[model samples]
Target chain A: MTSLAGLIDRLEDAVAHRTPLEKEHVQAVFFLFPLMFFIVGFILMPVLGTLYDAFMRDVIFLEKEFIFFTNFRYLFSDPGFWNAVRFTLLFVLISVPLELAIGLMIALVMNETIPMRGLLRACVLIPWAIPAAVSGRVFELIYNYSYGAANWLLRVLHITTEPVNWLGSEIGAFIAVVAADAWKTTPFAAIILLAGLSAISEDLYNQARIDRAGFMTRFFKITLPLLKPVLVVTLLFRTIQALRVFDVIYVLTGGGPGGATEAVSNFAYKYFTAGDFGYGSAASVLLFVIALLLSLFYVKASRFGEA
Target chain B: MRGPDLHTIRRRVSGRLLILLCLPMLFACGRGDAETDLVFAVGGAPSELAAWEKVVRKFEADSGISVRLLRQPANSQQQLQGLMVAMKSKQQNPDVFLMDVAWVGLFSAAGWLVPLDNLDRTPFFGELLNRTDVYDGRLMAAPVYLDGGILYYRTDLLEKAGMTRPPETWRELAESAKKVQEQMRPENPGFFGFVWQGAQYEGLVVNFLEFAGASGGIQLQDETGGVRVALKANLKALRFMRDLIWEYEISPPSTYTEMQEEEVRTFFQSGNAMYERNWPYAWTLHQSDGSPVKGKVGIAPLPAPEGEKGVSTLGGYHIGVSKYSDRKADAKKFAAYVTSKEAQRMVVLELGWNPGRGDLYEDEALLERYPHFGEFKDIFRKARPRPVIPYYIQVSNVLQTYISGALARNRSPESALEHAQIEIDSLEQRYGRNPEGGGGQLSESFPYPSFTHGEAVP
Candidate 1:
């Protein structure tokens, strides 16, 4: 205790002698050190390790041997890997725009000053709040060929004479996967866009009203231009998330129906579980590179910083 | 006035930061237990886990050794993954665990399983033990239970169709299925003639093996692990499976899309089908008190092509001790206890599981309760396992894609098999043992001490 008291006394003297700017600099570095340590330990190290593993033969029953680019060579020629890539890209192309459009309308409705508006916003998030795996199982039941809601409703509405095989056919499996994913993730897009919508000043709408502008005209001329930055951010975020889609497809289709709905993530995970780490790592590294390139393109195309 | 409060807040924040930095150190050094209890990992349905718990308790009481029962995920895939992670990192706790029949090849080759030569192997089936449990000419695992594909037919429906016995050939089975379907369609629009596992999974491969007749499919050419998959028999079987869905129209379209073991079982139990192919466990469920098919189901060997004996795919869990266990002696004792005839009988009586021991088939009480045991003995004896190779899962994945693709009519069976054969060849070259002895480091050496029979416990 005496030694601690003496050290505190010496620290007070040192603090008094040092410039406040230097002390502030020390505190700033002290605060940032932990964050930097975590970033390096958790994120950076594993990624680099995976990059290293991709170039080695790391199967569980095999000896580790450094073989540069061999795994990538095999992966590129693999029809199953290509099939997964095509499915993932096609999924993003369809689901992203579908989600954005649905989310925009939802954001528009939730932005209105209505009764129990807060409750409505929270309720809109319920599907998003549920874990993707849980929701995927629910959707699996919903698409059941024998007694699912989709077929039952179709029969009731007289839309078709027979029950459509929703998860067995390639096209059916693709559609089911997209619909399930959009249902789970659209609310995230909506919440982000809702914040952007709320940030738009009421005065802008008031000015448009005074100018005798219609609602559509005001939205097109003012709202969309101002919302461009947020839209770009949401697109980039959702695109990255969609590229790495795994849990929902895993639970629902299991990359089944002849591998029609296998995404790149699921493809990589299969190899990993099968104890072929080198092949799995190579597949994942390819996905990471694609995600990085796409994000860069989005940023460059949108001129996000200037916006 | 604000300077003193701000100073204290800064101090508090720095103190918290220090704690945060030390947090990882705590976790890094956290596992300090001088743990002596044997950790046994097992996974199954809730009822199966409860049965395992009872068996564990009995062993603990008899041996005077405490045992920890670790419950893993019910899904076999997840269970394999959990064991892989623990074994790869070489955690010693999961001293003993249950392994799916398919994983024995990988686990044994990876040197994760401890040798068990001391235990008496007299009771277990010699063929199953040699096929799955033996590696490097040494015993590495012991069978805990057994499973095989069986033909389930509705007795009343067969009798109504003026048939006294189940069909014995694929052609006959198809004809009978169509005959019964035509008569039953008017009463139940949802009725079909047959159902089996055709979804893209491990079960699909097993069904294909059975369909390929007694020799099964995919021959391992030699010790170097060369595989031949595009065989004439496999093509015939694939075409017949596709015809069952489209040509004969005896099975539902969903057979290729969704039918698994449980799905096929439920369909047959609901009286929607005349013939069903599934595991032996489904019999108990089909004959349950409230079931629609109670006392109306009959079991037989799956039908094969002409002039060939029917084959069932061998499947079940095996108990093995981890090589890295700190408590191998105790773990081995537990393994022996689990595989002992008494424990096996208890498991069979309580859970309705097929006993891993062959002698149990002759037990009067068991046979009295389940007369079907007499029929299963021959089937189990002849059940052909999927190739017991280290990279069987990868090979199975490739097979799953192309086989289901053929069933789905995406390609001709010949072309699908051709492409699948090419993919599997490359996989074998990559994962198989290399001539230089640099790849597929199968544990061939045993420097570790082997257990001695009738040894005193320390």
Candidate 2:
């Protein structure tokens, strides 16, 4: 038979035994739980709200109804909605490739042993640092027919005799918006690609040079394959930023010289401000779904896992 | 290994309590503690802010109520969008709102404004009864100083262009623009003949309305207190504007995209524009001591096109009490003081507002303070308020968007006008009329169409 002390000792053993320290595991959970909650609260909440609002009837101020795909039906039926979607898609398709190419070229240039690399790096950031609203306002002046720098420069180059009201004409406005958006976002893409370029081991390039591999061959084979992951990340980030483009388009011509530049976000903002919370939410949902689909397609095409 | 649990339990308890306690503290933070402090709201423009801040100081001193004035920033759509955001706060929407006259119909229709007709029984009520404040025969809000658009021309430049007086017709104005462009701005290639608000917003509607009326297009006409839209006249006027930008190239293409009265003023002040179509505030600011255009400017009536009538868009704001205001009695006192004859004089003499009362403009002393007062004040008297229907805001947005698209997107003007007329008809049906419907109509001279049947267009 055990004594009273012995029984107390056993009880204390049951109560006082502690698990080993899991600093890494605890640290991971501490960081992850908050990040998980933030994703759910800020990003997911709005996204879910947008989805529900998309399908419901817009009964201003009342508890909205579940109309079972009516809003989507309306969205599909509207020409304006389709116009915005088509324009937005074309914009993404045109801009993404051009922006990506330019970004890579810029990254290559900056990565070289060139003089004034620091100045060039800082200069590259200038376009990205400018707020879209300010950029839009500034470019509007730059694109103005009478006073704008574009026409002045064009005149100097002897491109056209007459002033091109870049924002006044439909095609001019389209190209102008595309050019402006690309200029601002290319810097972001370049910075991302530059980071990827810097991470590459010097030994690999040296080995390739010893093997007498040409610059293009080396770039296409080793560098391209290795940079695939970073390129994917840059594409994902820039596409999302460009997909929901508003500030520049809104400020420049307000989706004018006749809605030529009305992105989905601009359309969403109009309804949102007009007190049509439901319609606005529906437009937002459409944007979200399109962005999601595009992201999924790009992620698959880029072979994120395989690469 | 054995570890301390008691401290852990204590920390856990405190953390849980802290989380629970945070919510009520947040709720408390949201509510106001100062019962005596009054917050006043106003839209910002240099002329108006200077005037309003002075009024705030004087009101706080006399009434012994501490007034906190918050000025709304100036940006297209985004600035106005901020006001809608502040409305979500149960504590914030100002006690006394400086409501834009254009938004008076909209905010009231949404039941955002507290009906002040029943709120007041003051001597100023008589004048209030006659104005646009009483929508559907309910006194929706109170009037502050009034605003109206007029032409600001370079007087010296006009005389130099061989025009002895202001152009009385659109043709003459265009001729004046061409003559002035040749005379003064030939060496300076960036200059424009005229600068006006042409963005797809309310200002565009107002600016377009003035041009339409001047071109013999009446946007709205009331016959026996019932309204009918004279769509043809409006179409003609819009076509003229389309021509003004496209064919004549008098008003720059940027005008088709510029959103506010201030932008026109900016271009004018820079000497980039020969004439500007803007509100009375710009005219006042130009005459101020520091103005670059102070001694260089002149005022004139917006000329008619062909054999049409001289008309300008009625532009200004109304000072209204919010529905959710806790201190209704105190707010009424402030409103009374603002719309009073003496207060109007203060605004006119100090800030250059064309007060709602017609008599204030006739005061010689007030006229002395504003040298160009005689012409702009004369222009204000002839100005017309926009279609006061609540749905007009929605309808106008459609009209302006399509019109802008036509000019910007290269769509036809005729089709855009036709589309607009049809859309407006549908919007008009949603409005509820007063018991004495069609009670008061301006004479048949104003000829905008009536929304007889609210039906969708093809």
TM-score winner:
1
The DockQ-based CAPRI class assigned to model 1 is acceptable
As for candidate 1, its clashing pairs are none
Model 2's i-RMS, to one decimal, reads 7.6
Writing each residue's lDDT as its tens digit, candidate 2 over B315-415 gives 66777776666776677678777776766777777766677666666678987876566766566656677766554555566666767876563777665
Candidate 2 wrong stretches, greater than 4 Å: A1-18, A21-37, A52-74, A113-122, A152-163, A198-211, A304-307, B1-35, B118-131, B160-162, B183-186, B216-230, B258-260, B270-273, B288-296, B421-458
Q: Write the per-residue lDDT of candidate 1 for residues A1-307, one digit (tens) a residue.
A: 5754665565455446545764674467566777977898899999999999999999999888998998897787788899999999999999999999999999999999999999999999999999999999999989988878988999899999667778877888889999999999999999999999999999999999999999999999888888889999999999999999999999898887878889999999999999999999999999999899999999998995565
TM-scores vs. true structure, each candidate: 0.90, 0.83
> Per-candidate RMSD vs. true structure?
8.0, 7.3
CA lDDT scores, all candidates in order:
0.85, 0.70
Task: Tell me, by DockQ, which candidate is best.
Answer: 1
Q: What TM-score does chain A reach in every model?
A: 0.91, 0.85
Give the RMSD in angstroms, all C-alphas superposed, for model 2: 7.3
Error of 1 at B57 (Å): 3.1
